[model samples]
Target: MSAWDRTTSREQVLTRIRKLAEIGKISDTGVSRLAMTPLDRQAVELARQWMKEAGMSVRLDAAGNLIGRLESPVAPDAPVLMLGSHLDTQPYAGRFDGIIGVLGAIEAVHAFVSEGLVPQRPIEVVAFSDEEGCRFNKGIFGSRAMVGRLEEGELERVDGDGITRSEALSIFGGDSARLDEAKYAKGSIAAYLELHIEQGPVLESLDAACGLVTGISGPLWLTVELHGFAGHAGSVPMSMRRDALAGAARIIAGLQDLVRAEAGTPAVGTAGTLQLFPGSRNIIPERVQFTIDLRDMDMERRNRLEAKLRELIDEVAADNGLTYSIREDTNSPPRYCDPELMDVIRLEANGMGLQLPELMSGPFHDALALSYACPYAMIFVRSKDGISHNPQEYSSADDIAEGVELLYRTMRSLALSIQGERSGGKWESTTA
Candidate 1:
């Protein structure tokens, strides 16, 4: 018999995934639940119901994080074991990006409860809000708030519809005024674990069903705006016209050249979004705004590339006679998974007769945010074609089941093992 056949409810997990997909579902398979929207709240409510059924005491924190706690009879006040991923999807996204993680964790906890064996520490499953960051231009809002990592003026940031994050949080049943109350005291969390789709082609290429995350390459998000004089396209001369969009195009292309030079490494750069003022067929573009996403596992290399990219932007703007401004939206350094947790997962996978490949995640997860507060690890289910944040993203049921089984085993080990001590502000696990 297979190792997961008796533990996790694969069918039940899949059912809940399907049900949640139907909430803000766009295409037959696409989901559009942006953060803090009414549709996102509906999905949160559904997950809350499932958490209740799992014998958890659930609550929505002031930062809009949906948390479900399973108290440990042995040490109710001890540091809690947290497992979760976000539920918010990109504007045009697939069904399983962050959905499976939350559902899979709930299933793992439910299975644990069914055994009637008390854990050594409390367990909490969280569905972090705004992990997608499509609406407010900031991701991991919920997780960051929990760790007191929020920046000033975040509540004032406006979305496309002119709705501030503060207003949206209020409508979603969150009180930003009491956000400090949601912050978890240091050492209050023993560790964090997240299960998510690979979101890249690594596992499928290796023919592995599940992989272990070595570390996350946090992205540097920047918004650049260029200004120039607007004129009639027909009247603007080829050499004399100062076109902001032209300058933006050159900088975007130059960014590609900068990152591609470091080929064979994890370095990557993208200008995913762009906008132009007076956007007309005949009007010369006066202003252009675009976003930059630069990531690398190596901090020095990433910083170097960022400097070069900035220089490229300056050169382009000068050549085009355009003035520009840049705003740093988010700058997160790389975060590694705990060695102790990785060892636990490795042992669990070995016992299940599964081969787990170790890979670095190019895309960050909520685990990256929680990594600041506690030791964290991630289990990645094979993503078909390595496609994510799109309608075509998918992972097989068998693969997801395998990943969840590993998570369940890992959670059980950490939750029931002898408690660890906090040394030098880090949780040092004594468990093998």
Candidate 2:
């Protein structure tokens, strides 16, 4: 335990996260720091200041990823051991969703400095921007830029206010014209580790403090539009009216049933957003557009489920005498955590007497983008009631502290392993 003041470190981490939460405070407890917003910039600046205070060199990448680097004294040129997550929040989001991972990395670095210890490999903490995709309808913007996966046309995509992503990047101090510079060369990152709250109930249900993520479920987002005919609500009889909203409602219910029937598997579906044209009490909706977000750890199963959904939508639309169109907005494949890193995390959890069950992440994360650049892993602390992306989402302070401690230990172990391999020695286990 290298003389690390656990209590003080925990307090500091919590205090910083709380301060950032205030930047975009909504209502009594929600957060709304959308990507590239003024509050988002404030949060990034605050994180940069904290990184500097922790004695790390800090800078923003071309895509506006706030990076804090702690160079290793023994192996400065070794591939960087990266630690990060996003800072942007969903509309009225919880405080912990992406905030903890970035701040937790900083706390880990501060602990090393406080203990007069320099890791064997450099550690870099990154706070990625626009992970929620709330404004631009595209997630993992900064991370995709880092891996050179972002297409140039994506910059032209506009937000609700008709602001292009390119313009938003400029506002965030990121030059989309120079986005290529943000790409990391292959093998430059040794591994990426992120700590986040389990936005699901698995951990809390099992009475566990934290869990090691096995993989992140990929999502396929589709905008389904049903077109029928608008009619006077009182004048059109239920049997004669071809109401698009009614047809959409039936399809949404079918989707829920489909997922429920796929029990024992990781498959899930949601009709998160629905809009009705001619939204009036006196008129039947002629057009209904709804978003379907389906996810599964198994790609095959996910695809199968998607096919079934398409069939259901078609059948429902036909039965209701409505025309239907389905457009795939985005598709991200499932990403598995590195098995070797999973082993390291398991060993540490057992050594610390922490309950660390393996779990799959239903929500997508920045790690999915970073996976293209390097091996990645995630640690999830228990979220109360398995809730997130809302004001009620909560993770206890003690649970978050445990997660931070695990992250620190994992980074330290990886650093040492990299150093050992460089010195003509086999990597040694860091567990007792």
Best by lDDT: 1
The superposed Cα distance between candidate 1 and the true structure at residue 262, in angstroms, equals 2.1
Q: Tell me each candidate's TM-score.
A: 0.84, 0.88
Please, what are the lDDT tens digits per residue for candidate 2 over residues 375-399?
8899999999998989999999999
All models: lDDT?
0.91, 0.89
Candidate 2: residue 330 Cα off by (Å): 2.4
For model 1, how does the per-residue alpha-carbon lDDT over 23-95 read when each residue is reduced to its tens digit? 9999898999999999999999999999999899999999999999999887889989999998999999999
TM-score, prediction 1: 0.84
Q: Which predicted model would earn the best TM-score?
A: 2
Clashes of each: 0, 0
Output the lDDT of residue 47, model 1: 95
